[model samples]
Target: MFYRIITLKTTKEIWQTKRSESNRILGIVNNVRLFGTNFSNSRIFQKLLVIITERFETTISSLENINDLSTIILAELLNAL
Candidate 1:
């Protein structure tokens, strides 16, 4: 019947609309997850840099000249190698 056809078309339209909306929400969720991952990585890198700088400053605080600092750094690098 005509009424049955109209009802079937409306139901199909509604299902399609819901599918599109779900896809859009999924895209937003993926973007948020990527942003969270990048933010956490940035925070970790920043913390590591801070720790390294603090330790280096403390180690070199007693040095009076560039030559002495360079010598210490070279020795440390050589030891690492």
Candidate 2:
């Protein structure tokens, strides 16, 4: 049986411990760009998606450096309400 692993405490920990390392967006884009489409029918890829997605969940978020994110989005996200 296939089991999906997920936990809020663990999610919180990774978000706090690692944020910049997260690359969910890049993976998704790569999956689309390279393979033309490679998300569905791929459990391994799905797991990767979840792993990095959890990075977005955090009690606190910060942008130590600005990248492609717009100023408005960065400001709203870094100083979340």
Candidate 3:
């Protein structure tokens, strides 16, 4: 069996692409949650809120509202890991 080796450049490119896609999707979801009256109270939204608080070690009220949560998550992934 042959194995493929990935280069640093390829890894970086893949990371950048995934990050961009994640940010795009997060923005779309955030817009829907911000505008859709009933979505804010949705179970998924509440779960997301809990996750954010846990990840940042801060309460939801203490966290500053950001339009792009993916940036925060990506930064944490890069730095915290």
Candidate 4:
């Protein structure tokens, strides 16, 4: 989980709006939060309202699948087990 609040010059009106935006953003994304913005009434809001999708996990190998072990090492591991 992560949260960020960029600070910039702002008035009270925009502060309330961004607070609501934070909840609305969390409703859709699993782990995220947003606070006041540096700019109001700008396209930054639209850009921020993006999915920002990307790969979360990558393929990794575990000891159960040690397919590239040498014969001697394999024998040693089996004997140690």
Candidate 3 per-residue lDDT over residues 15-78, each given as its tens digit: 7755664475467557666876454324434455555424344334443353234335533332
- Winner on TM-score between 1 and 4 is 1
Task: Count clashing residue pairs per candidate.
Answer: 0, 0, 0, 0
The lDDT of model 4 is 0.33
Model 2 ranges off by over 4 Å: 1-21, 37-81
Superposed Cα deviation of residue 64, candidate 4 (Å): 37
Q: Model 4 over residues 1-81: C-alpha lDDT tens digits?
A: 112223434556456555554454445332322454343322332332234222101111222244333232322322222
Backbone clashes in model 2, listed as residue pairs: none
Better of 1 and 3 by lDDT: 3
User: Could you give the C-alpha RMSD of every candidate to the true structure, in order shown?
Assistant: 25.4, 11.8, 10.0, 21.4
For model 4, the stretches where C-alpha displacement exceeds 4 angstroms are 1-10, 30-81
| Model 3 weakest lDDT span, ten residues long | 1-10
Error of 2 at 77 (Å): 11
RMSD, candidate 3, Å: 10.0
C-alpha positional error of residue 67 in candidate 1 after TM-score superposition, expressed in Å = 66
